[model samples]
Target: MRVLIWILLILALAIGVSLLVGNNEGYVLIVRPPYRLELSLNLLLILVVLAFASLHLLLRFIHYARDLPANVRAYKENRRIRLGHASLLEALHALSQGRYQIAQKSASKALDLGEDPSLTALIAARASHKLKQKGQRDYYLAEAERLAPDAEVARLLLQAELLLDDRLYSQALDVLQQIEKIEHRFIPALRLELKVQLRLNNWEQVLVLLQQLEKHDGMESWQAREIRLQAHQHLIERHGHNLNTLMNYWKRVPAEDKLNTRIAKLAADAFIRLNAGNQAQEVLEMSLTREWDSELAAKLGDCASTNPQKQLQQAEHWLLSHEQDAKLLLALGKMCMRLELWGKAQSYLEASISVQPCAEAHLTLARLLDNRGETDAANRHYRLSVQACEDNK
Candidate 1:
């Protein structure tokens, strides 16, 4: 509708101009010696309008021509950016799909195209690592670090994780330490460090990491608890060779952990091995007071305390509440033997055999019988002990 109105307006203006020109009796004349020129004013006006329009068109063409090269360059740059972004996306998809080779290729292409070079390099590194191309992985990781030094944490985290997966725990630990220097409270880094420390048998560091993970909610409570238990157990074993070191380590153990049956049993056995029978007895008694365990009760029998009478009294006291517990009965038999109460030891050993018929109980009973000059009974019990051991196996 606007175009039709414009057309009518132009036609009307043309008609008005033609009428006015036809009515006008005006002309321009020029003479230069022998040459003379004459023209109507209306014709001159029309020529001037055409000249202005042509000049405007020429200027527009010149402006477009001057900018052509730069415009082309900008267009190519934009195209490269778009293509690089597409390649990056393809790399991510291929990586997620487990196509490591394709992902690495695409990410490398993206990196060459200069699209988020650091991110592309990291992606390529991950893919290379997955492909077990250690050389390429390290190269890409170095590129990532060099390209974006401000993202040191990211590069270090990836490097640590890859090293850990390769079971190069010491290398992973070094990388993790670098990350800690940059960002002390990174949860993922801490979790990775935990794994590295565990693999390295750095129980002390494992405990520290576990504490941080638990505090940050980076690990499940139960999972952290189990790891903590393992760390403490290993720490105990690590120091078990030296009596002073073992005692110092045990003293540093948290009171709550000391009551755990497994930890207590391990500590007790370690103490017994170091000839610290009193300490072993103390650990067992403390753990048993918290929670009863048959294995712990059985282990208690091996704690050869200096005060045999006192230890025997403790085992007998336990027997009052655990009359049917086979391990407790065995412990009582061993304790009675330690105190040289042969008749009581024989009764307790027999009772323990009646309850569970274990090889240890039978062997203890047979030893007691043999000491009393009952060769026939001792022989029969020895055969039963062997059979029991075979049955258990």
Candidate 2:
């Protein structure tokens, strides 16, 4: 178009100059000494202008002709991009409508147009997955991964989710680990990593993840503490068969923690297993001191009265506070009987039966009375003891 315009312009100039020259009588010019040339100046001017204009127009036309293929290619690329954009929009709409087949078709068509190859690969992969085309889905995913080595988080997350859904826990962990290696402490990746660790029973890894979560206040304090406690308990139980490790671990646990009723109970059992009744007694005493637990109090009293006079004193001190509880009363009664304090034993046994009647208490009192030569009262109490067990049942 520019070439045609230039040519027209040159033609108009040529015609104007020719008319001016034809209307003029020829103009003469003088030359250097001993030489003169006669010429029509206006006609000479027109010829020179026409020659330059022709050369310029010829060069322009040659350049434009040389660029024709490139222009055609550019036009085709632009048209393809527009089509791809339209196809992508249609694919997205179809996907939203749950038309998996149509979405796959449109996405493929979009990829065939001039869309970004990496983006095209992802859309095609997702669409194929939705359509249950496993082979095609894997191929597209592989292609996308190759094209964009720096994979998108959303795509990686989806892949991990799929692996998890299939119960491919190790594979899912591998993916999450890769993401962590690339972008350490990425929140979603770390969360998925923790979940994978939990699924695999990698308790050590879970503890570390829990610590990280705690730093961000991501988990409630009690929740984190509960998980840690569970992990610690598991670790302890795992090594419980090894006496040295179990003893060492138990000793290293903080004294305050040992006062927890559950911990105290477990520790007491462990101590009994190790034949360290004294340590068990100490744990029970500490636990009872913190809170009045009938269970711990009873265990403490039992342990104290098991062996010697010193532990008896400990049982007596505990009983001073819990004497009203029937279980504690029974414990005290048995301890006094073991010590041969028959009178004190009878007092406690009677007190226990009075507060909360139990077959054991009635029988213990009856036996004390019988041994003391009160046979008639002993027989009465014995019969009442038999009836008590049956009535409670």
Candidate 3:
């Protein structure tokens, strides 16, 4: 539409100029030294317009010619950038698909083409690691660090993760420490450090990391609970040989964690092993008061408190609520035996056997019968104990 409009305007102007020129009686004369020239004014005007148009076209052509080399360079540079971007995309897709070799090849190509050098190198590093090519992986990681010196945290994080996968825990921990020096509270780095600590059996560090992860919501509640339980159990065992150390450690344990049955059982057993029966009893009571566990109840009997009657009272109190619990019955029987209430012990043991028939209850009952000179009954109970153990297996 614009071209048609321009063409009509040009025709209209030409007709107007022709009518004016045909009516005009004008002329232009040029003289120079020995030569003179004369031309009609309409023709002179046409020559002048054509001369201006030709000069504009010639200058435009010259300018285009002058810039042609730079334009070619720019086009080549743009094409390289586009191809590098495509290669980077291919590398990312192949990596996600687990085609490690292809990912490595494409990432290397992108790196050579200078497409975000640090990212490309890191991709190649991960691919090499997946293929178990440690040397090449290290090379790429070094190149990544060298190419992007400001990305220390990213480089160190990847290094730590790869070292962890290799089971090089100490080295991984060193790398994580480097990251911590730069950004102390990084969540993903903290999570990786937790695994490293756990593998290295640094139980104290494991506990610390668990707290950090819990605070940051970096771990599931149930997962943190399990790891925390394991860490506390190990710490308790580590201090078990010294009664004062064990008790001190127990005192520092969080109140909610002390209520966990498994952790409570461990602390109780550790205290009992160290002959700190009062501490064991305290731990068991605290745990059982929060929630009754049959295993913890059974462990309660093992605490040889100075006051046997008091321990027996505690077990009997638990019996009011857990009457059908076989382990609790066995524990009550053991407690009763400690207090020399033979009749009560016998009754509780028999009740435990009737309920579940475990080896410990049968064996304890046999010992009690043997003490009373009931040889035939003791032998029968002993056989039953052996049979129960075999059935359990």
Candidate 4:
């Protein structure tokens, strides 16, 4: 339909032109002193239109010719970019597959092709590290640092993680600390720092890291508890001989944490070591009242309070609730013996043996009997204690 309309329009324009030419006596005249030139008006109009079209085409050709070298360069650059992208993908794949040498080569090519050189440099660094090419790894890492100074934190994090994997704990710890200085709230850095501290046996630092990690909910309750327990145990050992420091540290520990059976036992033992038996008794009694623990009750027997009657009463009271608990009976027996209540001591010790038959109860009973001039019975109890010990082993 368009072709038909154009053909009709052309015929109409031809007739119009013809009519105009026949009806007009228009002409173009160029005159000089010795020459004159003339052309029909229609011809001049056609020539003017043709001259403008030719000029536009000539300028277009000249423009293309002038830009030919630049255009070729752009095309080559585009090709290189495409190749670089492919190389990057290939490098990533090889790295994942553990083909370190191939990954490094491809990543290097990607960088040379200018495919986000900074990123490619980092990839190459990882590949080099995996290949155990320390020199190459350092070189690539340096290049990455130079190419993108803004990514210093990221590079440092990678460096720290790599050191951690290699078990270079001290180096990793230094890097991790650097990360903490740079971005205090970064979760990954906090997590890594905790691991490094633990490995280095920096118990105090581990405890500090654990507190920070808890704010982020970085660990499960059980995991946090386990780590906290380990840190406390180590710190307790460090202050073992220094009674003042150990008690001071325990005072600072959260009250709720004091309820943990192991920590409570540790504190009680430390108090006993310092001859602060009353203090030891207080810690053990507080924990036992909150929750019954056989181990803590056994540790309860070790507290050497000045008033044996009071300690005995406390054990007997616990027995009312935790009836048939052999450790409590053993503790009550020991407290009675301290006060020279031989009959009650003998009865409690015998009852403890009937309940649990542990070596401690047997040994305590033997000592009570020996002190009361019942040598034969004491010897029998002593033999029983030795037998129990062997049986346990």
Candidate 5:
């Protein structure tokens, strides 16, 4: 349809030109300095039109010729950019599929073609690391850093994460601390720093870093508890023999966290180490009231006081609520034996064995039986204790 329209328009133009030119009966005269010329108007008009057309064609050719180099350069640049983009996509795909060597080649190609050279170099670094080409990976990382000095934070973070993955916790910590100094409490960096501190047994720093993480929602509540538990256990093991230092550390912990079972046990044991029986009793009792733990009950039983009967009564009170808790029975048995309540000690210890046959409970019962001069029964329990300890080992 477009072709037929163009043909009709061309035919109309031809007919109109023919009528106008065929009836022309005019003349043209041109006088230059050297000569005068005269011609028919139709010829003159056709010659003038042809001259203008020729001039337009010549000027157009000159314009195109002048711009040729620029246009070619632009075309080459566009093609290079396209190739780089395609190479980048291919590299990412290969990296995802664990084709490290292919990814490394493509990333280098992208860098050579000038596609965000710094980022591509980092990609090459990652690919090299995946291929276990440590030298190549280090070269690419250094090249990336050189190409984009403004990307120091990103470069450092990646290096730190890589160190962390390699279990080079001290090295990772060094990098992360520098980032922390500059970036100031970046959440991801803080998380990494916490792990590093924990790995290095920096208990005080672990607590500090965890608080920082908690402030930024970098650590969950349960996760904070778990990490804190590990930190507190370590601190307790280190300072438990020093009464003043242990108390100072315990006081620094928040009251709500003091009820944590593991921490409470640690505090109680530390207090027991310093012969602070009442204080140890208080820590254990405080934790038990908040959350019932059988293990804590057993530890509570070990807190000896001058008045054993009173302590026994206090432990026995828990039995009203936790009737069949074996650890509670063991705790009661231990206290009863301490007070020399022979029959009651015997009953609680045997009941503990029925509920949960623990080696420690068996040994305690065996000693109580020995005190009662029941040699054969005591021997049986002593043998059971040895078997249980071996099984546990």
Candidate 6:
């Protein structure tokens, strides 16, 4: 279409020029100092048109020649980038399928092909690590760091992993700490830092890091609980005398979280360690009110009091509510015998055995009956304890 338009335009211009030339009745002359030249109007017009067209074509050729090198370089770079992309994708797929050797090969090829060498280096390092090629892993990691020095996150993460692999907890911690400083609140870095701290028995830092992790919606509740247990264990070891500090720690935890069976159980143990028998009793009582766990119920019975009568009475009350809880029944029976309530102890102990016959319950009953001088029944229970123990074995 465009060619046809150009042809039509040229024809119209030619006809216009022809009419102008034909209508011309006079000519013009050009003169120098001592010479003169004269030509037809058509000849001068043709010369001017040829000069303009030749000049335009020459300028266009100059421009095209100037851009050729840059366009070729761009094309080569683009091809290299595409090859790198393909190599990276292949490596990732291989890694997912557990083909560590193949993944390593592809990642290396990507780096060699002049792809984003830094990224390829990182991938190669990971693949090498999985393949257990320690030398290659270290070399690739070093290259990645050299290629992208400002990528502190990737460098520290790799270093942290290496230190962890070597069981160098302190070194890993140092690297992770530096990463945290460089990139505050980085979840991946913080997670590694948390694990290193745990290995170093640094519970205080574990608590703080866990709170930061909780801010990330990706963290699971179970993971948080595990961290809490570690933190609690550490606090108990370090601050056993400071009830106020421990209480404040508990207060900072969400109320619903405190209600977790694991946390509740931990809290009960903590209270018992503190020798706050009354508080432990209260906490366990409240816990048992909602959950009839045999383990918690047993612990609750033990935490009731030093006074055997009071302990026995509390256990019995719990038993009324949780009659099916054999552990609670055993605890109550054991306390009754401690208080010398022989008949009641026997009844409770026998009931525990009936509900869930175990060595523990049988042994308790045997001891209780022996204490009351009921020789025949005590002998029978002793035999039952031995039988139960053997069965479990």
lDDT of each: 0.90, 0.76, 0.92, 0.87, 0.88, 0.79
Q: Report the candidate with higher lDDT, 3 versus 4.
A: 3
Winner by TM-score between candidate 5 and candidate 2? 5
lDDT of 1 by residue, 91-152 (tens): 99999999999999999999999889779999999999999899999999889878888888
Query: What does candidate 4's lDDT look like per residue over 83-182, in tens digits?
Result: 9999999999999999989999999999989898667898999999998888998898898888878887888888887788788998998888788888
| Residue-wise C-alpha lDDT for candidate 5, range 122-162, written one tens digit per residue | 88988988787889988888988888888878778878877
lDDT of 2 by residue, 129-164 (tens): 777687987786776676666666655766676667
Worst 10 residues of 1 by lDDT: 206-215
157-216, model 3: which lDDT tens digit per residue?
999999999999989988998988899789999999999989999998898889998998
lDDT of 1: 0.90
Order the candidates by TM-score, highest first — what do you get?
Answer: 3, 5, 1, 4, 6, 2
Candidate 5 TM-score versus the reference: 0.80
* Residue 358, model 5: Cα distance from true site in angstroms: 5.0
Model 1 residue runs over 4 Å out of place are 1-78, 132-135, 165-171
**Candidate 2 Cα misplacement greater than 4 A, ranges:** 1-161, 251-259, 301-323, 326-393
Give the winner by lDDT: 3
Error of 4 at 88 (Å): 3.2
How close to the true structure is residue 346 of candidate 2, measured as C-alpha lDDT? 86
Model 4 alpha-carbon miss at residue 69, Å: 5.6
Ranking by lDDT, best first? 3, 1, 5, 4, 6, 2
Better of 2 and 3 by TM-score: 3
Q: What is the lDDT of residue 139 in candidate 5?
A: 89
